[model samples]
Target: MTRHLPSRRQALLAGLALAAAGCAPLPRAGTASASSRQLPQERVRAAAPFPMPDISVPDFSASRRFPITDFGAAQGDQQKTSAAIAQAIAAAHAAGSGVVVVPEGVWPTAKIHLKSNVNLHVAKGATLLFSERPDDYLPAVMTTWEGLECYNYSPLVYAYGCDNVAITGEGTLKAKLDVWKVWYARPKPHMDALVALYHLAAKRVPVEQRQMAVGQANLRPQFVQFNRCRNVLVEDVSIVDSPFWVLHPYLSRDVVIRRVKVRAHGHNNDGVDPEMSQNVLVEDCVFDQGDDAISVKSGRDQDAWRLNVPSRNIIMRNCRVKNGHQLMAIGSELSGGVENVFVDNCHFDNAGSGARSTINNILFVKTNERRGGYVKNIHVSNVSATRIAGGVLSVETDVLYQWRDLVPTYERRLTPIEGLHVSNVKVDEAAFVCRIQGEAEMPVKDVSLRGVTVAKVLEAPVSTVNVQGFVHAA
Candidate 1:
């Protein structure tokens, strides 16, 4: 007997009620709770266009401090500092809860791995200059490259299966890109390696065996990744020049990334990538990136569907973009699904001058037939931009960058996109106001635009292919 599956509408409705079903009143920040010995919860209450729960984040203000200097970390010494950071982190975790402090100095390090209940705090006037050698990130860890899971080179700062971890302070975390700059080129060898990884993921090979850190793979590691961790926080840190994505929260939950500044213009250097994560809040951050400022993603096609964890209840507000392809981009790697995202009160400050400007759409939702997931209830409001290279809103259903020809479809399933709303957005100039290139079978639905004023439109005001229930107002 053939079993019946829920229709797209049913799935979307179920997702809409997910937050309300699992939501509970969280304790305010700094309050003691039953899990106080673990990570104390802090309530994050923000007004969203859809139903959302108050996100819980880690609070480490009153924790004990373990200064790296006390652990024999010396300025300008890479090996000693790296060992010292590890020691300090171990000490903090052993103490149940503590902050691993990096004192005020320019210290070179290899990789800093965070543990549970440990906040790696870089103090004022401190800069952690990461090493450029590839060997420093050896011994492949569980990480994802472009949404596909693998045991690749460890990220510069990685946390795996840890609860209540953070990286906070008024200092800079910079990457020395001497080697990573050359690895950015996608030559024939790199393309072949990506194809191999794709086939492995499609075949459901064990993540342990799908290593891409070998010779000529050139898969750049993210600067910071909180992998499968809970109650994560990264606040008030300045990041300069990353190998890849600046800040990544992958398969994690209850994350808060606030007041961070990222200036990474290297290839594929997205500012923040919240991939397959839930209940995340990114606020009051500044991004000058080489790719999208905020790219929300789930996993890739077969691997993502196997994981079956959709990114849900994400909110990004009061953020500023200096240069990026989009203010917020969803998908092109989303197969697990994405829903109930809210982007509010963001500004794209003159996105660099002249030819350097790269601002694109305010909100771009992109997927293809292989994605096989659903996107719904995405809302963007109160956004202001100087000049948009693309448009205000763009929903494309046939966006498979190099995979269009690089790899064949292992499973063919079209994405179901609906309930996209944008309001109170003003841009000085744009190619269009709205562009929708939806498939005929699954036309984009319920797209509403209100008070979207494009001062200058270089092309048609609205361009659409297959869209339903499209409402536009002045």
Candidate 2:
């Protein structure tokens, strides 16, 4: 059964995080409908079916304890509030406490760095409202993504290379991301002030000379970033209106995310992105995003050439994707390859059209023009989707930069994907055209489809004759 453990530790921690972040005491849990119809009980899957193999992650439960903070009560600009909260967390860590409290209120602000072994909890009715003012998110940090270094907007709640960490609560954490429209990077200033944001990013003396604003990019940033973290838990929070990707667990392991709500329409506003990570679990979450709901990626081309990790052992269940690109997406970043992912009991409806853009692919995996690794061993079942405009299944690769002369040469030592299984998949509307291709040298092998039904059928069908490791191309 899909149980709602609203009062679980994660939720409790979310509530506490909000209080510490400076929100006021919550009135009552909002009664807004869950945004989508509940799927048949039989359709939902359990987390236990796909076991969590051993991975590296510290148990923060045994780390020094920390208390939450309230950002609303602090006076002066958002910098003051953020600084106060930051000090509180740092003090806790120095005292050997790992938890910091986030009190309730409409706490306004910008970039706030996260500490190690700290649990930032948000309470119900508490909202962390980030300011649209450009000067708020200041300074530059040399951060990496799947192992790429490009200057961009910093995450609102930024944490890099921490262990045994978590964020939980039942509250509204708002990032007035659309406010970026105020910058000059955009064409028109519509709902969000992107033009003003461009101006903020346009302070182009260059980081080599400019001190604080070196790493500001034109693209929006992730709201939550766990870069190379271990033993992470992000549970039971209502994360709304993110500026970019909501919950990103990148290059980490033994991560768990449950009962989280992320609603954002900003460019590249993915709900959850696990890049080059291992042993992950995402369950009972609701995603109303502008981009792919949940995406897995490893480095891309030149970036991929260096990273030595692949995403593996990923499990997802009882999750819903409302306005998104793909409910699940493996990527163009397959330079390091992806594998061992199981997704089931998910609902995708009213998707494709959202606040900002439309999605082009669902169940999307790409490795265009460039090749380094393989994507394989995926199992999906009991998924129901409605109102989708993109290709139902697209397994081909693409190259944004056209390189006509570059030959597509593959490798034998690649982590070739095998053992694919899909069943009980139902889609309401699809136009046509579904291509599930493996490398010509490694055309997907060993695929099984049982009790699978699609409302619209494409001319092409997926199948693979299997013996040992089945790698179905569908």
lDDT of candidate 1 vs native?
0.87
Q: Which candidate is the best by TM-score?
A: 1
Query: What does candidate 1's lDDT look like per residue over 164-188, in tens digits?
Result: 8899999999999999999898889
Each candidate's lDDT (Cα)?
0.87, 0.60
Candidate 2 residues 175-206, lDDT tens each? 77556643324333221232222222233212
| Model 2 deviation from native, Cα RMSD in Å | 12.1
- Model 1 ranges off by over 4 Å: 1-37, 351-355
* TM-score for candidate 1: 0.92
RMSD of each: 6.8, 12.1
> TM-scores of all models?
0.92, 0.73
